[model samples]
Target: MSTAGAHTQHPEHTPGASVRRTREKGEPRFPDGPKADPAGSHFERRIRSFQPRRSRVTAGQEEALQRLWPRWGFDVDGRQRLDLAEFFGNDRPVVLEIGFGMGEATARMAAADPGTNILAVDVHTPGQGHLLGLADQHGLDNVRVGNGDAIILLREMLTPDALGGLRVYFPDPWPKKRHHKRRLIQPAFLDLAAARLAPGATVHCATDWEPYAQQMLEVLTAHPGFENTVADGGFTPRPQFRPLTRFEGQGLDKGHVVNDLIFRRVPHADQPADRAGGDHGADRPEDRDAAGT
Candidate 1:
């Protein structure tokens, strides 16, 4: 389950969201395990926030994936609680980055903070290859790649309060009004994040899509377990650690504005008892139960 492979098709309800699907008779209806089709035929296995796209992978990128991935990449289908010390071979604080497209920013961030282990997740194969290539190029041991549904990884594999920080940068805006439901920063997503983040842990999200930025701000502000880092509850200036992405640079040329939101996980006293008590390095019996380990 920890290895990268094809998604096992499950033409049934996905957790946290009910999706309607049509499949031919006798097609596999249950998620057996990771199957390796890059075509992404197993969409029913999870209601993903991003659509899998087919992109060209150069020979060098493929070479990097084959060589470096065994050391630094993992699949999101893992069900057991991942031991951070074992995963990174270190005790450093770990940051979970969701949807690290093309991985330039992800690699830069990993380079900037050598003490923090970054477990970046994405479904794009080429991007995963590209990021692995960068990690190899820079000799970075702190960066790891994950491919599959991030939601499942957050809910199933990660223990409560096991994260030092989380970053989600420029996720697909899903611009149509009707498609807003597909946005990743929903209330339920925040709830899952609250359960996994340690007290005082931060979630930093950035987007160039204005509407999505506003929605992200509203949802993060509304979540009781988190408090905005800004003094007036507005967007924060881009931190020096975040390099401007190519997409963001193009948007800037077109007069588009980017917004960054940072929210800290509130303490136990500030949140309801049910949502409290997941401080970093603290393990509870419930974690084992949650992972069914």
Candidate 2:
């Protein structure tokens, strides 16, 4: 018998029949929430820095995504440029947080510093919903959740010097030697990040992977657009502003050493004017690793 005929005959016995019946082609998983693939076909496929994870979203998360997403969240479709001032409804300096897992720390930071706005980007659906819920619960109007690729957000959406600060807490180490190119702290990623960050803005990164931390130090040091905040050009202590996440705490419990790198974006008057537009020639980091904070 043909597969379609069999399914038609035994609709009750067909696997995922209910799901298939409810969801249509090209329809979003959650109609009012972040898109599954926001950047769809607008950009070329390339080596990605992070991998997406398959996980279930909780009831509360689903509710939050449905209710709060329209107000405080947006999909990174790479379709239009965003005005940071207008998006946040204020002229406060906007800090771009590359990957916020579950948004516990992101919420805390937003609560602590209400003066600064945080645009937290992540591909994890549950995390996206959870963050939205947290922001709503805590009345954090300063928090905005961005779905899809951070690279696309930087390259296609945001204007030059659109960010006041950038935070990358515990990005994927990509420990395998063959996968180092997929790490988020590569030279090419730095170039793009530097272009979006305003001069004197701080690019703060933290990680427990020793080798990756060293690589981050080296790359930031070599980049002419950035300067290490520490005079000694070594790892700096984690700042008070950055909350200690449960993931980081667990790594510390296992005797893992966490290194923090705080580099300031410097003015590039002597360099070519086009450098501020970023180097789009290389494969950009797509999303944050699920294992990352």
Model 2 residue 227 CA deviation (Å) reads 0.6
Best by lDDT: 2
What TM-score does structure 2 among the candidates reach? Answer: 0.84
- Give a tens-digit lDDT track for model 1, residues 73-154: 7767655678887999988778899999899988987887687889998888778878988998898989988878788788
Tell how far residue 172 is off in model 2, in angstroms: 1.1
Q: Mind giving the per-residue lDDT tens digits that candidate 2 earns over 105-124? A: 99998898787889999999
Candidate 1 clashing pairs? 6-35, 6-36
> What is the RMSD, in Å, between candidate 1 and the native fold over all Cα?
11.1
In model 2, what lDDT does residue 144 have? Answer: 89
- Candidate 1: regions farther than 4 A off: 1-46, 270-293
Candidate that scores best on TM-score: 2
Question: Residue 169 of model 2: what lDDT?
Answer: 93
